[model samples]
Structures are given as structure tokens and as C-alpha cells.
Target: MKGMDVCFSGLLTRAKHLADAGENRSDLAFSLQESAFSMLVEVAERAMAHCDKKELLLGGGVACSKILQEKCRIMCEERGAQMFVPANEFLVDNAAMIAWQGVLEKRKANKNYDEWQPNPQWRTDEVKVDWR
Candidate 1:
């Protein structure tokens, strides 16, 4: 949720309200964590179904969270899919993945490369796929 603007702000506001109401901090924190993990699992499962995938791989720093790993494990089990997580040492921040995206975009560039710029809102189909 770090880069997720709306959800991150909403979660912080909720946490503040709960704290002001004298809710047990540990319980409040776990509840928030669980909610976030559950949302991630729900979305992952949807993607798995959409792609007819039988394996789920949890990557990046968030995969180091034991709670999230457990939730994803249970979800994968219920779907009769396998879930895989790399060792904690490999779950470092996503800088490598981010950089690899630059490599990919470079491969997609051509004579019109000057038109290149990151466009988060751009449609996937809008990309020329000759690089494939």
C-alpha cells in the first residue's frame, strides 16, 4: 500500500480514528494488516483465475510478511493451486523489477523512441508488440 494513494491515506485515517477511540493498538494493527493481506489475496486469486494459472508466486519485500504469506498460502490451497515464495533474502525492495521495466521499454523503442515516456495510464494494447 506504500505507493497506493487512496488506500494508503484511507488506512492511515482509519488507524488514527481507531487509536483515538482507545481501541487496543495490537488488535487494531493486526486487523488492518489482515485486511490488507486479504485484499491482496483476493486480487491475486482473481488474476490466477483469469489466466488459468495453477501456481502463485509471491515476490518482492511484501512477500517477507509471514502473515501475508500465510493468507496467500491458504487461498492457493483452497483453489488447489501451489504458492511459492522466495527466501527472505530475495524479497528485497523492488528496484530490480523497476529497472527491468526500463530494459523492456528500451527494447520496445525504435526510430520513434523520442516519443518514449512513462505512461501509467496508457493501455497495454497501445504498446507496439514487435519486441516480442
Candidate 2:
């Protein structure tokens, strides 16, 4: 997590420098996004290797980026793994996914729905998969 913070900080610093140098906003944005997405893919690859997992699922708003999708696809192909990315509409935060996941979990067993408060800033790793 600390490494991720540092990586993002570096991207922000680079972006600032580029902006101050009068670089095109689009170029700066793309550069930062590419760097950040590259880091994300690297970490994902490591996680897959560590867990011996052959499937990769990319979601969230960042997954909508064509560049990220392509990079992840190539990475998965190189590793002989399957990569799943939802459609653009589902790539971002959507209630449908959340509701579907909740329904699936509910079907497994009785979960403490009362304890599941909505968290706008929730991170995927932060959620405890008690059903699992």
C-alpha cells in the first residue's frame, strides 16, 4: 500500500511538472494514466502469480480505459490466463454490480446485512469476504 501511495505521488509530481512546463493537458493526463495503469497491471500480475490464479478480472472506472484494457489483455495472454473486463457501462461504479454481488452472497447464507453499511470510499481489499 505504501508503494502504491509513492507511485501515485510520483505520478502527481510528474503531472505537476508537465503542467508547469506548459505541456498539453491531454498528453500529461495520458502519461500519468499509463504509468498508473502499468503499475496496477504489474501488481495484478504479481498477485496472480503469488496465488496461482489463472483468471483476472478488471473492473471499476479505470477498466474503461482502452489502453489499460489492452495492456491487461496482453499481459494475461502472455501469462496464459483469462482476463475478464466488463462493458464500459459496467466498468464504472454501478449499482447493478453491487446489487448482483449482494444477491449472490445472500444466496450463499445469511449475512449480516445490517452490518454492511454503504461506504462510498470502500476499497476492494478492505471488504472482508466472510462468505468465502
Candidate 3:
């Protein structure tokens, strides 16, 4: 997410060029996956160091990749930390997390999503936390 934000469109363009140059699709995919996984691990390591933490928990759909899991595990091992990746089924589905957030909002009577508007300029610490 650093250094020009590394857009996915750029990766797609690169893959297109590679495909045009007669590169095999599997190799192109492998290259893109490696590039993405490396960037993710780099950011994760920086965050772990900043927080002085020794544990890394990966989630989301990409977390289901065995290559990404192996890369994260290696990074954690080299840093003497622990990397926790749940089963593939748990990695991709976030319905429970969304439901938990709903529960929290319900507890605080903050269920009116229609009243909310997007504010891209707002910073994390500046946001209101009435639901808490």
C-alpha cells in the first residue's frame, strides 16, 4: 500500500503485456501472486515491528492461498514471531465478523445505516465512536 499505492490495475496491465509476449498464463499468475504476497508481508512486518508484537493474524479471501500462508509463516519464523492462519473456510468468510459488528451497533441503538454518509477525508482517530 506504499510507494505509489501499487494498484491492482497496474498488475493486470503487466499480466496483459506478459500474455501478449507469449508468457504462459500460469507463470503470469504466479508472478502476480508473488508480487502481491510480498507487498502484503512487507507491510505486515512493518506493522508488527511498530506495535512491538510477536503475533500475526491474516484473514480475508487472499488468506486462503497456501503460498501467502507459507510466506507469512516464513516471515514470522525469521522474526521469531508466531503466525496464526485459521482453516481455509474460516479465512474467507467474514459473515460472523459483520454480524458481530451489527450486534455491537444494535446494543448502542446505532442501526440506522441510511443516516450515515461516506467521508473520505476523515482520519481514523477523528471519527466518532458513539456505538462504543
RMSD of 3: 6.0
User: Clashing residue pairs in candidate 3, if any?
Assistant: none
Best by lDDT: 3
**Deviating ranges (above 4 Å) for candidate 1:** 1-6, 95-132
**lDDT score for candidate 2 against the true structure:** 0.81
Question: Which scores higher on TM-score, 1 or 2?
Answer: 1
Worst 10 residues of 1 by lDDT: 1-10
> What TM-score does model 1 achieve against the real structure?
0.64
Residues 36-132 of candidate 2 have per-residue lDDT tens digits of: 8888988888889989999999988878888988999999999999999878887776777779889877767666788666654465667777656
Cα-based lDDT at residue 84, candidate 2:
95
TM-score of each: 0.64, 0.63, 0.65
Q: All predictions: root-mean-square deviation over Cα?
A: 7.1, 7.5, 6.0
All candidates in order of lDDT, best leading? 3, 2, 1
Screening candidate 2 with a backbone cut-off below 3 angstroms (N, C-alpha, C), the clashing residue pairs are: none
